[model samples]
Target: MQFLEDPVLWIAEWLREVLLGWGASELVTNMTLNFLGAFVVGAMIMVIFILLTWIERKAAARFQDRIGPNRVGPFGLIQPIADAVKMLTKEDTRPKGADVVGYVLAPIVSVFSVLMTWAVVPFTQKWIGADLSVGVMYVAAAGSFGIVAVLLAGWSSNNKYSLIGAFRGVAQLISYEVPLFLSLLVPVFLARSMGVNDIITSQTAVLFAIPWLNIPIRGFFVLAAPLSVVIYFISSLAEVGRAPFDLIEAESELVAGYHVEYSGMKFGLFQAAEFLHSFTFAALMALMFFGGWQGPWVGTNNLTGWLLGGFYFMLKTFFFYMMVMWSRLTFPRIRIDQMMNLNWKFMVPVSLVLLMGMPLIDYGLRGQELWLKYLVLFLFNLIVGLIAFAWAARADRRVKTHTRVRFEGRPVAVMPQAPAAAEDETAG
Candidate 1:
């Protein structure tokens, strides 16, 4: 009670002093400045999302060997704006049998959920919306609202395909959430706190005046265990419903899937929510695995820290986002059965092993020689990876052989007819 008391008064007093020192007014001027700062940050995040959509489309087009939106503006930079205008002007449609309220509200729910999640994410040391102690858990909880919205969209549409897509979306997200949590637990455990700021602070290198072989090495989770980084990335991709994990929106099978009945700006809102969600997850992953707002040579100054850290963070997130896009363009979408099997058979087991092994490895490396730990981790990864590859190859060979059928009957070949020009010339 004592510790929590007078927090507002303390902040006000500190602000009053700072304002007086700067030759400004007590309360109104400081409040106005704070509000302006928050508004600018929010606006910047929105702008980043718009640019991200353009970048994604351009990247996808380049991957498929085609020119993407070059007519709207320079390199089609204004394509997203045009798309927004078109969606806004288009006729809104609702199917006759659809549930009117839920059908209309679902997209708004999804977009609102996505935007709310952004409030907890810190852009810099000083520039964050809420900065709650439970920031990470807040994000996780808020993200699940999209699942509710998707399910509502599907069920209220009165479409079988939409319902099936919604089911797929829920199942995939739930299954992948397990691995995501497990992988994320590594960082949280190391940080010793669930707060996002604490996790970032924990990434600083430990410096001691004494040199000893048994000294604990402090660094980012990515440096400590690269496997968790990989697992988190893969799980996040599945969470976002990107291919080859995108069975939820399988166009050939489900005809636009859960959003089948949505039209005009409503449908556009759903699409925008999806892209925004993906961007948010990518940023979260960047903060977790890569150093959040921490750069190599730059110290945490207000402007430089925000820009450089944000730049590095965006660069890392965009790289992963492009990888997701590449997989979407390069690989075929898996069947529903294959998708479930992957979660149950491969990702679940691998994530479990990693979850258990990471702590044990950390314990073993705590006081042991560095070279010995490296050697053991390397050997273990190499052996397991080889066995997994071999098993996959053998399974693939068996599948090919089982699917191949030999025809016993004699082959009958049809020859092409001779050209009419040859007959005409002979006749002439």
Candidate 2:
């Protein structure tokens, strides 16, 4: 029964024994297993990336009231495969004066960084790539590689538009990380652990506790730290360059952004990286704020249970991924200035207060019932969120009023007319 529940572990153990029986060294056996595990993970991510392309296109088509990809295959299921073939066969090109090394490496690094983050994601209670004590920090570090990739692509392309896009991307990503990092700390604070798995484990306990009614309801961190989740979600959008925060590829301004000079499969790599990065953050949100691999009928002891737990985790992740797609389809992309103001002015302050204030609340409620602690935390989130929103609203109104007053007396400018040619005397 145990083997059936975790067949990978079972097969690995069986392989280990076989190698031992053949006098294989322990180090060699361990290395072999690790390599196989990594290969499986990498393959799985690539397969999912293919599916995401189809899904995003179909969803976008529906959003725009048009049929998408139906001609390519059944409901366009084969569209991604066809697209991949086209990308593979396209002529590879690089502009003159481009740095060969950075140009060649940039796309590879972009995709690799997204793949690296999956190392810490827990699919089921027992199925995780690595359960490092500092998994949170590792994820942060791995994700930072995308910044390097963007800079490399831009600087090596030798294009003014690509350089501008790369500069904007770095600024947006680095600025938003402040809020994103702070929001991440809220879960770390609540779980009192920096490990990803530990955070998920901590959520397995009481989800919600109502002291007034003496009723204990299941709860997730989202209920306790609603504001943190909001900040995390928004900041993550910018981090991944998703719209309406997708300033990285503001085509109207940058004509395809940092990857403008890339072609063939190299450009495909950038596309794959963007899609995967969005899904990765969605999965992270599920793990941190939702009860990852935790739901009714999810058995930790059996294979069926493990499979079901993975299903639930993916379901949660897909929900958020759809939310990202929905936002992309529904909202117009904001300007660069507005995006910066949102991160530096709003998300940063709210996240800082949440991060610093959460520990203090937990301290004051020391030795108290878990439910009481969560209740106070929930109320605290609400108060902070309300105050932040109110302040933002007031600031917005003030800016609007000031702009209206300043422009009220200004004269409307007329379009300049071109000089007319003199009438020909011969024609007269």
Candidate 3:
């Protein structure tokens, strides 16, 4: 009956007992368990990656008003499996002058980099894969591997288009990473810890309070640092190469981008890496901004609480994942110049402002009441937000005027009108 409390640990304990009885060393048993846990988490992510394909397709279909993949299986449930088979059976090709080593290793590195990020994601208080003191830095380092993968794919492909796409990807990713890292600092500063679990624990109090009415909401970071959340999400979308930040993969421009020369399972791996990476960042967003697994009926002190916490974590992550999909399906892809301008001219500056402003606010408001602290912070954010919006509006107006003038100045050919419309009416 105790197994019902925390089935995962209970099963592990049972396995330990069995292994010990069989004379296995304690170190070996522990190693076995850790390996199994890592394997399980990795397998789960891969399975979810398959499901994401169907989910995104169906969501896009709904947005476009069409029935998607109904012919494959019940509600198209087996479509991903079918697609997997196609990828497996498809012909694999390599360009004649391609660098075989990097070409083959590129997709593997891309997928591995995405997989490593999950190692630090805290699913629940007890269910985390790792609780490193520098978990936040670990995630950042792991993500940088993706840049290497993109470069390899582009340079190794021996195609000029692939090289160009890779260069653009590198530029976009590196540019957006500035704001992403800066936005991440807000949560770390607020929580005063780098561990994901600590960050989640710090959010246990109410985020906002109306003291007079005695109304309060749970202390999710989103409510406290919405500008940080916005910056984080937008920057993450660019990092994932999702639209309108998808200029790296702009088919009209680069003809399939960095992976253009990849075929068969190699291409499939790149696609899988992308889907998983998007979901990973969404999970990170949920963990950082939405309180990870903290919600009603979720208790971390008890073993049974882990199960409930897992449910809440997945729910929050799915919500954010759907938001990512929505953005991809709804927005048109922007030009490379436009994308760069948005990052350098807007996102980077705003994130730097937020990163600088948060620490000052926290320092000044130290030891203050929660309500007063959040209130002051909120007011400060509002002021900065209003100013930023005004600047953006003015810039947009200027660009529009310039564009209109440039287009209006182009020569136009006038069509000749009928010579005698009035006389033709009587003649007819």
Candidate 4:
């Protein structure tokens, strides 16, 4: 109880008088606390990323009906640590013709960009690191640096395969960013704020229930626009380069892709960044759509609120991570053309329409009954979801019967080429 009552107050006091030799200003003291808090948060996130990697491997193993990483301490709990050690001790080799500077800088850039995005993510009311007014924009902007690093890694390797892989990555991420932003805008519009903290606080405000139905229709963009959430999840999957969207590292075609020439800890950095990006996106998705830091069945008491909020945030993020891993293990890698088609044709248009339509619907329901609002929203989403599901089912059926064949630098249907036109024509 005492420990919970004052976590860092004692340390703060000691640092103020002993280290600074004077009482610190409010800004300085707060800054110090923020840094300390960020450090702890950052460390926890890193550990979560490591654990998520193991979870992914185990999940993938289960999907494939194989045992994965079971030898390293209790169901492979220590597998990540062992992998880290092996990476640390292994030889760091550079390709003969590779550009040393860019080759060395790429992984650092990738990891750093991912870490920078975390700076603006608010864990709780008092636990934000920076609390930038443009928090979402900052996250979006910082995310692009990773794409740059990937491109550089591929280009500087002086390898054709790496260059192609990097180009694929650039194309995938840039195209998906459109839908990603569109879906993200739904929450920002509903909250009417650019700050992450403000968005979270907005979600906690309660709206009065309608007299008859008694459904409280307030806060939570997810309840308001479920389609946006679905779009955002799909766009995020592409953005993070996960399965069905992992053409950038397609083993069969690209031969390990952008980091083909990398080895040792350098390559380890890329792998870490991949896991980190996946984890970070999951966290962002939770924050945006799931009322981040909102506890499950908890009152608004200070300590309970903070702890529960963080717990819920982590729980949702980890669950999403599991979903990503499940998809990776269960689905085959989509062809590059199919990837592009899905993004440009379906995701972008649907996201844009939802982004525009949701706000209008929300506005029109300003003075309506809460039940009416929810009913309308639910019906709209249900109709759209049914349409999408039907389309997907039809596409799947087509894919099952379609024989994939490539000819003359393009994919096509050969239809068995009509049995080579029978040489008996000459005998006639």
Candidate 5:
């Protein structure tokens, strides 16, 4: 498995060798290498954060059948550059009576929390900044920090709308974390390790190739625990404040949500964090469920392999980002209550059951053939789905009027008039 050697490690080793061979001190050489790695990772994540602004706009344009940013540059690739300039030059205005400290800290907290998760993510075998044994737990913890930022922004803004939005955000974030963490436990349980690198290594073998039938298989932990993947993905969308679950930022009600009092890059930074988190969420899903950095013969050398590894990671990441874009364009936003009910009433229970059941099934079927093992796991998923459907049907009868709550105080509402002939008949 020398082919699996981390490119980053090899490069650092080569640097160390050259430095030592030149009579340089070991401490200095090691320090230099660590600094270089940190610079590269930080720079890469920030650059992507800027580019994703354009990427999401372009993706949304395509979905809506509109010309996205063709005017700025070819396919509007430089559109984000223009927007960045605008945001930087704009006035940083603070609303009167706003808390200076928390208002400023909110954007920094929001952006940093999401960016820091990249430290433990393995782009290649050796590319990670840290390989902490509790990497998954670290990620889950980091992901929740955005909620703190939201609360700060809302409370500090001294705006009623901001506070309302912040409370809504708190509810959504608190509700989703349950399912998100529960789903995350599946991979941890199966890999028998919490380290992201170890989890990646455990998935090195074929996912599902049948010897008798000659059917090829493609899987990582995602295939073994498909329910977890489903729940995690849905929860992640909510976590990032995407549509259908974005009631936290319900513009129709909250008027720009928690950061309503901020202007200039401060406002821009909060917006960037939201979109950036969405992309990061997709990347994490790819790494967790899609055999991250595993691709066919990407590079022959350690250096080239590292390049290839980063490529595969980005490709897989953008694929999920596209899925997120599609989901946003397709679904209408649900009311706050519906959003809560969907998460707490449905997703939380289903995800809990899946998490509890997977280990039992795997242990009980340890001696059985691989196919039989999978069959039992799949049956378990099917039963959970049916249970969800039945519960939903029963819920429908109980909360049939739930959806109309959002329209309770409609103002400036106008009813459309029929065609001339229809209108004339109605008058007659």
Candidate 6:
């Protein structure tokens, strides 16, 4: 039997005992502990948000081969806090025609929506805020409201550009949602549960064998649902308004998007929500496809269990987050039309197919040896990958061919068309 002990939860129990000793009723003590635990999680997320800004700036600078905010506090560690202070003290202007209620509530809703989703994510074993039975659905529903926030920000601002940005954001969100939801089904089906904790538990087994090595890395869905992972990551990028998918805020186009009228802390709230959402998606992706907090099965010890579990969770979450930042730095923003096509035409179809076939694959693999299951998963994924690669290669060739033909067809010089023989026309 696997032993699980969460230090955070343990501390909460101890605190609850103290409250009880202070004449608190059982219900009161439970509520106190729960609230305290929530506050701690919120505080941790906020601190991470602060640190993430500095990390992103520094990381982006390195990616661009330049020094970032090194002037502030030994590598600009305190730069984000300084920025936060400025935002709080900064001049704020509300549009004359702005809707007072929605304008004020937009940022709050945007920030809170993502925060609410965090309540279900498992940071460590037994350390989730509220592990709902329908955790996956809860996350999806919570995240979907982000579109409402964008629309509210845009509409309340009464700015044409903001409205356009919001419209684009809505289209993007709705478009990517199909694939995102479909990809989510892969993990849910494989895990045979809608609960996020149950899904994490289901990823305990290894996927495939390493060539020439007998090592078995865990997370069967990573192999069985490789494309889903790719689709989920891509969709999450767009959902969070990161680069390449940041059409919502294209400064060259939208002048800052749905939150254009927002200044200072209000604007900062939007930024905070974006980073937090992106990182949260990283954690969710890690949980669904990769083993969430399931590293080497360190038997539950007294105090060290929580620490070790958290270390593993953070390692996987950060790995995914780092990759997200890396992609943001590396990839240039694609055209909006191309982005739409990628989601609607490519990602959606692939995810749908994967979603439909998952059950069939699972059924076939039932009553089979572990190795046989692994082998079937490996082959299915390999075939899909190869087909995708072939299609991409062909598309690339056609694009290159068209470009070359277009360039060659253009005449460098045509003697100005010989001026249409002006003298002869005059004589006639």
Using TM-score as the measure, name the better of candidate 3 and candidate 5. Answer: 3
lDDT of 1: 0.75
Q: How many backbone clashes does candidate 6 have?
A: 0
Cα lDDT tens digits, model 3, 342-394, are 88888888888888887899899888887677777777777877888899889
Estimated TM-score for each candidate: 0.78, 0.93, 0.91, 0.84, 0.87, 0.88
Q: Write the number of the candidate with greater TM-score, choosing between 3 and 6.
A: 3
TM-score of 3: 0.91
Candidate 4 residue pairs in clash (backbone atoms < 3 Å): 293-309
- Model 5 C-alpha RMSD vs. true structure (Å) is 6.3
Misplaced by over 4 Å in model 2 are 21-23, 207-216, 406-428
Please write out the lDDT profile of model 4 over residues 1-428, one tens digit for every residue: 34343344446665666645556676787677668767776787778777877887888888889998999899999999988889999999988899989999999999888988889887765567788888899989999999999999999999999999999999999999999988888778878887888888787755465669775545565776788788888888888898978999999999998999899999988988899898888888888877788754544545665677668878888888887777777788899888887888677877776666666787888988655665676567667667766876787667656635323357556665544566556556
Report, for all candidates in order, the number of backbone clashes. Answer: 0, 4, 1, 1, 0, 0
Model 1, span 1-428: residue lDDT tens: 12123333345456567777887775666786567556665677668778878988898889889999899989999999998889999999898899998998899898877887777776665456777888778888887888899899999999999999999898988888887887787677667778887887777654322366555444655765576677777778788888888889999999988999888999988887887777887778777766676665435654466666667767777777777777767887888877776666666676677667766776777877544554555455455546655776787677667656444444768656679769988999
lDDT against the true structure, each candidate: 0.75, 0.89, 0.90, 0.80, 0.84, 0.84
lDDT of 2 at 381: 95
Q: Per-residue lDDT tens digits of candidate 5, residues 145-174?
A: 888999999999999999999998988898
Better of 4 and 5 by lDDT: 5
Residue 395 in model 1: shift from native, Å?
6.4
Per residue, candidate 2 scores C-alpha lDDT tens digits across 135-228 of 8888899989999999999999999999998999999889988888889888888888989989988987774647787655656788789999
> What does candidate 6 score on TM?
0.88
Could you list the CA RMSD of all candidates, in the order they appear?
A: 8.3, 3.0, 5.7, 5.3, 6.3, 4.9
By summed lDDT, which 10 consecutive residues of candidate 4 come out lowest?
1-10
